[model samples]
Target: MRVAHLSLGDFRNYRTAELELRAGANLILGPNGQGKTNLVEAIAYFATLRSHRTSSDTPLIRAGAGAAIARMKLEAAGRDVLLELQINREGANRAQVNRNTVRAREVTRWFSAVAFVPEDLTIVRGEPSGRRRFLDDALVSRHPIAAGVLGDYERVVRQRNSLLKSGRGSARTVEATLGIWDDQLVEFGSQIMLARRELVRDLGDPLSAGYRALVDGDHGPALHLSESVVDTLKERGVSRETRAEGSQSNVELADVSRETLAQEFRDALSAVRLKEIDRGVTLLGPHRDDLLLTLNDLPVKGYASHGESWSFALSMKMALATLLREESPAGDPVIILDDVFAELDSGRRGRLMSAVSEFEQVIVTAAVEADVPREWDWNRVQIRAGEILPAGEQTSGTPEPKSPADTDPAPGESLSTKDSEQ
Candidate 1:
């Protein structure tokens, strides 16, 4: 899918700005603190229903303003679709598609976008929660039903935690209540586990391949879904043999059936009830699971150098983009690269540009115009003090349109076409 146009009103630093995008690459050049990122963030918000940078929606609204609005016209599967998001601090956020109001979930049905920013390096070097969030977000975008499973799991976790925190109840009563939560938690947690496992399994090969390509075929990265329940149960002598005979099969972590996982979850919660009561929190479930990233079998957190960590992060983003392209019915997801060009060396930057050029559309933000590939057909938008210049007046550079063959090239294909003389 490609965004044909975007309009912003009272959003961040943008007072009122409209942009028409090209099918190939659209470059947003600006210095720090300008509104370049805000423009892309608006498009991404329409795609994912959340901001990639901030968790709270308040900052998305322009200061001194009460509300913010973002409108996008998208072209997907040869059809034109319109998506709009309105956010007001004191009021409910609203969304619409094709001039019709839609439920929050239905808005996500319109488009999918994958973003790669310099901060994404945290996905590899940061805490487990971030990785888990990344997994869930990707799952929700690809399989909308996965959102229901995640929501259910979170609700159970919250209720269980609340009960643990309210120390006014008797032990017997608490245990009974905990039992109910455990059953529901297992039901939803198992679904989440099963969905995550299958997603990782499907993404494994593509992830490794994408990593190799990003690093110039020099290294392979491994993604492991680490689960506390699976590991905890095995420690408690719950043999795979006994578990396999039940409804769900006790296979590998990625292949563990939801029913089997639910059974294991129920058993683990029962065993850990005393410890949980003492700790005042629910400790053992998908909520505590992690997505582990290893480079050549070593954990990337402290072991990998800065450059390797960046590669792993970019690789993961590229893999997500590729996966969305294959799975999304709307078509290829629009790619947003935010201030990442400055983080890569010349070689890696070339590879990343090569990988991104294959997408239907790409919006990149950078401070240096030289960072962009000169050969690709690019539409440049220069931003200064929250103001966007018209395309022709933005840069001395002229528009260079990539041939159809170049614009729609297959993945891993070389983009070494002769530079168009502008």
Candidate 2:
């Protein structure tokens, strides 16, 4: 699916803006700080429900505004779907599909997108949390219902942690309530772990091919899950390894039953119960697991060079995008490259463009026109000082300075409030 149009009001630097997109190779070009990433971030927000750059929604709201409005008209399989979001600064966010209000997570069921940003390199080089997020986001893209499951899992963890902290009650009382929480935790966490295992297994082939396409030679890129439960099982007499260190070291998760996994999960919790009670935290389960990315039998985080890390991260995203394309009846998920071409060498830039060119739609943001490959017929939009400039308007050199008239909203002007007033 592709976004046919995007509308913004008080989002980032845009007070009010409208952008028309096309089926293939749409480019957003302007100098840095001219809102290039913000536009694509708005589009991607519908897919992931969070910003790639920040963890909080407050920053997404334009200063002095109570809420930010983002609306998009999408086209897929000979039909159009309208998706809208109002990101509030104080209250919960709101969502709409085809003008009908629904739960915010429901918006993801209608659209899918794979965004490649500079921060992706962190997935390989950064902490475990980033890698965990990558896995969860991939799961949600593969099955939108997974959003609810993830939400449930997170809530269970929170509630369980609260109970652990309040162990002031009688020991029997605490144990009784804790057992109920444990059951819910295992029920949801097991589903997540199993789904993640399947995702990693399915992504292996595409990830290998994607990496090979981007770089020369076979580096033997591979994925494995370093599961906490599996480790606990090994401590007992399960005889299964979590890492894909070698043929014998890898656990064939396909053959592993959820009943087996649930038992292992319970065992893990029991082993850690005392420590968890002392620390007042829920320490074992999917939240503690990690996706171990490796290249040529070595961990990518510490062993891979800058170039190799980029290739792995890019390949991972491409693998997920390919999986979504093959499975979704909604057509290809919109491929978004947000200022990514600038970071890659010329060869990889061309190769990356060629790799994604076959998709139904691609949206790219770049600060320099020459950074993007020039062969394709690109539908280009220019931005300056939060404004979508007309064709023939040059946006080279530094971003134009914003004047007061450009920054300030007119009297009685607010997208969220005005719509309600109408």
lDDT of each: 0.76, 0.84
lDDT agreement of model 1 with the native: 0.76
User: Against the hidden true structure, what lDDT does model 2 obtain?
Assistant: 0.84
Against the true structure, what is each candidate's TM-score?
0.88, 0.90
Best by TM-score: 2
Write candidate 1's Cα lDDT for 1-422 as tens digits.
89888877778876677677888888998888877888888888765667878988999888887767677778899998877666766656666667566555566778888888876988888888889878888887788767667878888899889998775334655776777787888888888888788777777777887877878675668788778886777677666553453233213555655676677788777677777887778888878999888888899999999989999988888888898898877889899998898998888888888988999999998988877767777788887666777544754433342212222222112222221110
- Taking all chains together, the TM-score of candidate 2 against the true structure is 0.90
Q: Please give, for residues 1-422, the per-residue lDDT of candidate 2 as tens digits.
A: 88988877788887777788899999898889989899999999899888888988988888998888887889988898887788878766777677666778888999999999999999999999999999998998899989889989999999999998888433543687899999999999999998998898899999999998898667999999888887775665554344343332333884568887787789888887777887778988899999899999899989998998999999999999999999999999999999988889998999899999999999999999989999999998988766786546766554442322223333124323322200
TM-score of 1: 0.88
Q: Which 10-residue window in model 2 sums to the lowest lDDT?
A: 413-422
Off by over 4 Å in 2: 168-173, 236-251, 394-422
